[model samples]
Target chain A: MDLSALGSCVSQVSCVVTQTTSGLISGMLLFLVSCGLTLIFGVLGVVNFAHGSLYMLGAFFAYTVYVPTHSFALAILAGAVGTGLFGIVFERFFISRVYGSDVLMQLLVCYAFVLILDDVVKMVWGASYLSMGMPEAFMVPPLFIAGGVVPPFYLFLIGISALFGLALWLLMARTRFGKVVRAAAQNGDMVAALGIRTPYVFAAVFALGSVMAGAAGALAAPVRSLTAGMGFSVLIESFIVTVIGGMGSIVGALVASILLGLIQSFGAIGFPLFTDGLMFTFMAVVLIVKPTGLFGQRVR
Target chain B: MQAKGTIRHGVSRRAALKGAGALTLASGIGGFPHIAKAAGKVIRVGMNTILSGRVALVGTSSSNAARLVIDKFNAEGGAGGRTIELVVRDSKGRPDEAARVVRDLMDVEGCEIILDSEASSGAFAVHEVMRTRGVLCIHTNSETSQLTADPKMHIPTVFRSARQGIQDAVGGGQYAAAIAKKKKLTRWMTCSPDYVYGRDNTAQFMEYAKIFDPAIRLVEGAWPKLFQPDYTPVITKILQEKPQALYSALWGGDLSAFIDQGNLYGLFHNIDTFAVNLGDYSVLKAVKSLPKGLHSGSRYNRIVPHSAANEAFYTAYTKRFPGQWPTNWSWQNATGAAFMCDALKKTGGKTDGKLLAAAIAGRTIKSPFGVKGTITMRAEDHTIIDYAVAYGITEPVDPYLTDIQMADWGAILEHEAEWKKKKGYA
Candidate 1:
C-alpha cells in the first residue's frame, strides 16, 4: 500500500484495538450481573425473575449510600451487604417452599416476586430518573493501555472481577464448606444423611448470589445512569451471558463476559446498527453448536 | 360442583327477574327523567395522557398547559354557560391502558368531548370512540403525521393543533441539512428514538434532505429503544462510523439521558456537527456541557429577541413558576390550549362539537410564536400549517439554559404548498 493509505490502515487498526478494549470493559460489567444469576439458577434450579430487581436495588443502594457517604468503598459495602440481607429474607420467606417444584410453578412464584420487588422499588424511589457518580477519590487519570485510553476505574474493575473469581475458586476448591455445598448440589439427600445442613447452605448460596449481583450493580452505577428500567436490560443480557458461559460455570462467566464485552465495543465501532445483535448472535452460535455452552457441563 | 352450579343458576335467575322488573320501571320513567337530567348539565371533557413512565414530563406539562387554558375559559364562564368539566386519566403510554382509560372516562363519566389524548396510540384509540360517538377530539402534542392526514387511519372528529410531521420535517430539515452541508458534513446519520414519531420525523427529514440534495447519502442510522438511559454503545458506534452530521429526534427522558451520557463521552466534541431535530430547552438544560457549535432546534425559544407575545408569555410563565424556565414545547402546548379556548369563546361558549372542531381547524389562533394568523387547515388533509424554526446552541447561561442562534428559517418553509398538496387519509 502507498504511504498515505498505509497510514490510514494503521489508524483504522488502532481504532479497532481501542474499540476491543471498550468491549472488554462492557463484558466485565455483563459478567458481574450474569455470575450471580447463573449461580442462583444453578443451585436453586429456579429462575429468579426478581434478579433484575435485586440488581436495581443494588444500584439504588450504592447511589443513596455512596452519594451521602462520599465513599465508593462504603457504597459497595452497603450495596452488597444490604442486597445480601434482602436476599436472605426473600429466600427464607418466599423461595424456601418452592425447592423441588415444577419449572412452571417456580416461574409463577418468581414472577410474583418480580411484581412485588418492582412495586417496592417504585415506592422507594418514586418514578423519576436518579443521576449518580462514583466518589471523587476513585477518579483516576485515563489509563493508556492496549493502544486505547480507558478509564483507570475500568482497570480496577478488571482486577476486581479477576481477584473475586480467584478468591471464589480458592473457597470452592480448598474449603470443607465448599465441599459440602458441592455435595449438596449433587445429592441433597446424601449430604443431609451425612448430617450437613443443606437448607442453610442453600440460603448462604442465595445470599452470596445476591451480594454478587448487588456489588455488580454498585460498580455499574458510576458507568451508567440509574433508572427503573435499567434492571430489565441487565436481566436479559445476564441471561444471555449465563447461557453462553455455561449455565453453572463461574470461570465460564468471566471468560464469556470479556468475550462479549470485546465484541460489543469493537462491534459498536464497526457496526452501530448491529452492535446489540452481536452478543445474541454469539450466544446463538455457541448454543447451536455446543447446546450446553462453552463452559457448561452436561446434566447427569 | 353440582350444588354450586345450581346455587349460581338460582341466584342468576332471581337477579334476572329483579333486572327485568327494574327495566320495566326504568322504561316507564325514562324520557321525562332523561330530559330533566340533560337540561343545564355540565358537559364532561375527557383528557387522557401518559402520566407515568419516562414521558411523564410531556404528560404533566401538557396536563398543566391544558388546565391553564381550561381555568381561563371557566373564569370567563364555560361553553354556553355549561361548565366544561375536564376529567383526566393516566394512559401509562400504553395502547391497552389508553383504550381502557378512555372507555372508563366515557362510560363512567358521561364525557362529551375528548381533549388531548397525549400519545399517538392513545389519540387513535380515543379518536375511534369519538368518531363512533360523534364526539369532538382535539389533539395537542401528538404530531404523528398521518393521524389526521392519512385517510386510511380512521380517526374521526379528531383535529390536530401540532403541525403535520411532513411540514415539521420540511421546516426543520431544510435548515438543518443546509447547515450540515455548510459545515462540510455532506454525509449524515440519524439517531432517533425508535418509535412512530421518531421514525416518521427521521424519515421525513431524510426525504427532505434527499430532495434538497440528491448527493447527500445517509451513511448510518441508529434507533435505540425509546427512553433507553444509555447511548454509549450506540453513540460510540456512530462516532466510529464518522458520519458528518447526526440528527437526533429523541425527546424527554431519552433526550435527557442522551445529552447527559453524550456530553460525558465527548460524543458531540468528536463529531464535526450534530443536530437534535426536536432538541428543546428541557433536554439542553439537563446537559452539564454542550458542544460549542452544536446545532439544535425548538418550536419556540424563550430567548427569541424582540417578540411581544413571547415576552408577555415568558413573563407570565416565569412569574407563576419561579426558577423553572418554560420550554419551547410548553409554550406550544399553551398555544394549543389557548386555541381551543378561543374557539369555544368565538362560538359564545356553545358546546357544539362540530363548530368547536371547525373553529379550531380553520381559525387563526394567537400564540407566542408569531402574530395571530390562521392555522389554514388544508381541506385535503386536516393538518395545520404552523411555525417552526431551527437554531444552534451558541452560549450557556446560569439558569441551566443555553442561547440558541437562529439559522435559516425561510428555506425550511419554501415548499409548504407541495407538502400540503401531498394527500393521505391518516
Candidate 2:
C-alpha cells in the first residue's frame, strides 16, 4: 500500500483498538447477564425467557433503591439481591413444574412467565419510562480516545465484570455448593441419588445467576438509559454470548464474549448501521464452524 | 352554574370539599392510583411506541418527547390545574400488543386524552378506543390517512402532526418524476417496506408519477417485508431492473441497510436520483457513508427555517441531549407538544378535554419550524392538515450526516398542493 494509505489504515486499526477496549467492557456486562441465563438453562434445563425482564428489574431496583441510599455500591447490591429473591420465587413457583418437559412445553411455560412478569412490572412500575440521575462518581467525564470521549464508567464496567468472573470461578471451583451444582449439571440423576438435594441447588443457581444479571444491569444503568424493553435487547445478546461460549461453560463465556466484543467494536466503524447485526452474524459463523462452539464438548 | 352542578350531578358539599383536595395534590403522585386521581381531576395520556426490541430507537425518542412535554406543562401549573399524567406502554411493534396497550390505557389508566404511536397499526388500535370515548388523541407521529378517512373512526380527538403517508408519496413521487424528466431519465422503479405506511407511500408516489408522465415505464417495483434486515436480494432486483431512477420509502433500520447496499453497487452514479420518504436524521445517524446526490423527504429540517422558536428549541434540545438532535420524528414530537402547549395557554390552563379539543380544532398554533401554517383540526375528519419538507444529499459531515441535504418544507408543501390540485382532490 502507498504510504498515505498505509498511514490511514494504521489510524483505523488504532481506532478499532480503542473501540475493542470499550467492547470488552460491554462484553463483561454481557457475560454477567448471560452467565445467569446459561446457568438457569443448564440447571433447570429450561430456557428462562423472562431472564431479560429480571435484568430490567435489576436496573429499576437499583434506580429506586440507590436514589434513597445515595450509594452506587448499595444500588448494585440491591439489584443483585432483589433479583435473586425474585428469581427464587420464580423458579420455585413457576419454573419447577416445567423441568424435565419437552422443549416446546418448556418454551411455552417460559412464555407464560414472560406474560405474568410483564403484567407485574406494568402494575408496579406503571407504563412510563423512568430514569434516574447517574451517581456523582460515575458522572466523571470519560477518558479521551481517537478524537472521541470514552466514559470512565466503561472502564469500571470492565473491572466489575472481571471481579464477578474471578469470584464466580473461585466459588464454583472451590466451594461445596459449587461442587454440588457441578455434579448436578453433569448428572442430575446421580446427584439426586446421592441425596445431595439437587432441587435446592437448582433454585440457588437460578437465584445466583439472576443476581449477577441484576448487578450487571445496575452498573449499566449509569452508562445508558433504562426502559422497560431494555432487558429484551440484552437478553438476546446474552443468549448469543452463552451459546457461543459453550452452554454452562464459564471459561468459554469469557473468551467468546471478549472475542465477540472486539468483533463488534471494529464492525461499528466498518459498518455503523449493521453493527447491531454484526454480533448475530459472528454467532452464526462460530456455530456453523464448530457447532459445539469454541469450548463446547460433544454430548457423546 | 353552581345550582345546576348541585341539582343535576347531586354532588353534596362534603363530596365537593374532597374533590377540591384531590385537585390540589395531582402533580405530586407517581403511582397508578395516585397519578390517576392527581390534581383532583385526572387526565391520563396513554402512549404506545416501540419502547424495546430492535425498533426501540424511535420509541425511546417518542417516550422522551412525551416526558418533556408533560413535564413542561405540569411545571406551568398543569392544564386547567388538572394534573395531566402520561401513561406509556411499549407495543414492541406487534399489532396484538398495541391493541392491548390501547385497551389498558383507556380502560385501566383512565386517560382522557391519548397519544398514538409512530407505528400505523398501533395508532389505529388506539384510535378505536379513542373513538368510543370521544376523547382527543394527539397523534405524535403515525402517518395513515385511512384512520382519518373512516367515518366509523370519527377519531373525536385525533389530530395528526406529521404529513400522512399519502402526502409523503405525493410529494416524493412528483419530486422524483420531475428530477428524472429534467435529467432525461426514462424508466423508474420503487423499493419500499411492505406495510400500510410503506406501501401507501411508495405506491402513491409511483401512481402520481404515472399520472404526470403516462409514457414513462415502471421498470420494476420491490416491496420487502417490514423490518427485513437483509436488503441484498432487493438490491439485486433493483440493479437488474436497470431503472434510471429509484424511489423508496425505506425508514429507520431498513433505510440504513438500503443506503449501505445502494452505495456498494455504485447505484448513486448509475441512477438519476433516489427519492426516499422519512430518510432523515435517524437514518443518517445509523449509516457510516452515503452515496453522493441522494434525495430525501422530511417534515422538519434544522437548517430549513431560521425562526425564533426553532432557534430556541434547537439550541436547548441539542445542549441538553448531546449526540441526539431533533430529527423529523423528533420534530413532529416537538410540534405536537408545542401545539398542545399553545392550546392550553389559549384556554388559560383549562384542560377540559372537550374545550381544549375545540380550541385546537380552530387554532393555527405556531410551529417550532416557524412556518405560519394553520394546524386546523378539520371538524369533518378531525385530522390536522400539516406541511412537509424534503431535501437532497450534498456532502458528508463527521460523526453524522453522511446522507442527503435537508429539503425545504415550503418547497415540499407547495409541490404537495400543486399535486393535490392537479388530481382534483384539493
TM-score of each: 0.84, 0.56
- Candidate 1: what's its TM-score on chain B? 0.81
Q: Tell me the tens digit of each residue's lDDT in model 2 across A1-300.
A: 123422443366434444556568767877888878777776667777778888888988898787778898998998999999988998898788888887788778777766666656656764433444456676444455664334465667789889988898888889998888888888998999998887789899989888988888787655344445567667777788877987777778888778766655444334434555677888888899988777777622
DockQ of candidate 1 against the true complex: 0.28
Top candidate, metric DockQ? 1
What fraction of the reference interface contacts is present in each model, in order? Answer: 0.19, 0.01
- Model 2 TM-score is 0.56
How large is the i-RMS for each model, in angstroms?
A: 3.4, 12.9
Candidate 1 local lDDT, B96-150, one digit each (tens)? 7887777766665565566764677777766666666555667766777767666
How much lDDT does candidate 1 score? Answer: 0.67
DockQ of each: 0.28, 0.04
Misplaced by over 4 Å in model 2 are A1-101, A105-300, B1-44, B77-83, B273-275, B306-308, B398-426
Best by TM-score: 1
